[model samples]
Target: MSLARRASAEFAGTALLVAAVVGSGIAAARLSPGDVGLQLLENAFATALALGALILMFGPVSGAHLNPVVSAADWWLGRRAGAGLTVRELAAYAAAQVAGAVTGTVLADLMYGLPAVSWSHTDRIGGNLWLAEVVATAGLVVLVFALARSNRATATPAAVGAYIGAAYWFTSSTSFANPAVTIGRAFTDTFAGIAPASVPGFVAAQLVGGVLAVAALAAWYPQAGRSADAVVVPHLTEETALR
Candidate 1:
């Protein structure tokens, strides 16, 4: 895929991801504030599943890396060969992801009439939250690299979805797997966000998780280094044909 096309795919994918997150958070806030935790769990699981399927579907046409962290991690690990994302592409995608999350949150706010990511999620700090972030992000990155490298999960997108869903309950932070998504969700001011003050901790945990994921993949899936392409095929009408 050309650079332009890849960037476009990343933008659209990230937008969709944000929309799913914010939209679901708003709905949960109004329907069952008490169950917001479960709601986020479900939303994130579904989003990851949807994202994985979408990536598989679009991987051939575009790289389908909706998250800058994914793209950067893949490139750094030598998974992206001919089509690694450049600095400009990463920056653009990150901007789009953040904007998309904020936009989705605003729209949800309008519909739910709850303040966007307000006091409900404020001061929501604890070791569980941090540990959850670490585990969730680690699982997510591990899944991405695993399926892409092993070719087991690439043919079917269910693995990513399943991993995400399970991670939500198993991990704490309702599985805020992606940094971009985490940052974007914060804008919502809903139950899904980590307060601005808490953003740093979350990001640090996520990055560490991502790095650990890469290390784990490198150790467990050595072939990942020479993989044809880092493809996270989404379940779509059009499937990616491997080289």
Candidate 2:
């Protein structure tokens, strides 16, 4: 697909993803009432399932990265090999992701009869949460790039979704591992929202984690590295060929 087409896919995929997250969060909060744990369960389960479905829907067109870190990692790995995303493509992907996230949040809030563009006041900043962001993002990058390196791209949708679901419980930050997603979450004041002030720390931690994951992949799974096309599942990838 052309860059424009791929970017559109990225935008659409991310919009729906944030909708799943924020919408489910609002619904869970309403239905579960004071039970935070149950709300989380409902939100995580819905997000995971929707995420898997989105990846399967868009993986062929854009790799369904829907996350800047994944795009950056893929570009970095494939830069020298000539199959990675161009600098222009990377910028487009990032911009689209952030915009899509905000749109999704707005749509979700509208669905719940809230203002379309309300800013969240939910405080999610702290040392432990920062650490959790690092851990969560690091694991996510490793899992994604590692799969790409090993040519196991097709398995990524289910595996990545499952990991995110588990990370919601295991990590202190509820695993806002994607910068775009983090930004989107800051737009709503609800069960799944995060304060704008906390976004910088979370984004920084995620970027650091992504860098570490890239370095780790270079060292430990060097053989898994491939051309830019190998970064994720594309339309004519090995996974599709196998099927």
Candidate 3:
């Protein structure tokens, strides 16, 4: 597949993901104002379902990595093996994801009759939350790549969605594992918002988690980590196969 097509898929997928997340948060907050736990559950369910659906729809076109860290991790593995995305493609993917995320937040806000853009006020600043972000991100990265290494690509959407849904309750930070989604969340002051000031820490923690997961994968699956044909991304058409 062409790089442009792949990037487009990433853009669309990420946009839809943020829209679901922000939109669902707004709806949940409005519907269950008195019940924080209920709000979280509703948001988590919507986001988890939407994320799986988006991945299933876009995976065959772009690998459905709606997160920038995921793109970076894939590139990190592919570079040494010369089998995955090149540096330029990685940059393109990251940019598209960020733009899509922002767009999705704006769309969600518009749908809810709010400002197109606004800085979030929900403060998620704390070592505990930071640590939770790290754990959440690391778990996500490990789960994703582990499935790929195990040649269980077809199981990714359901597995990933289920993981995210559970992580919302299991983690203190509500598991904002995706940096692009974090950035998008910063655009709203609703239930899902995370203040912009808190974004850097969350992003840094996520990067650390992704890097650590990749390292672990390399150590555990030495052969799969190095094999060009071992990649189990959803979209690996004949054109994508390294000759």
- Local distance difference test, each candidate: 0.63, 0.87, 0.85
Per-candidate TM equals: 0.79, 0.94, 0.94
Q: Could you arrange the candidates by TM-score from highest to lowest?
A: 2, 3, 1
Residue lDDT tens for model 2, 188-224: 9988899999999999999998998888888978754
Candidate 1, residue 173: the lDDT equals 65
Question: In terms of lDDT, which candidate is stronger, 1 or 2?
Answer: 2
Q: Which ranges of candidate 3 are over 4 A from the true structure? A: 226-232, 237-243
Error in Å for residue 46 of model 1: 4.7
Per-residue lDDT of 36-86 in model 3, one digit per residue for the tens? 999999999999999889988988788888998887877787677666667
Give lDDT: candidate 3, residue 65.
88
Rate residue 9 of model 1 by lDDT.
66
> Candidate 1 on 1-243: residue-level lDDT in tens?
445565566666666666766677666666666776667655665566666666665566555666556666666665354334446655765666566556655555666776654522565468878878878777777777777676664543577667766776777566777777666666656656667777778778878877887788878986664442454543221123333
Query: lDDT winner among the candidates?
Result: 2
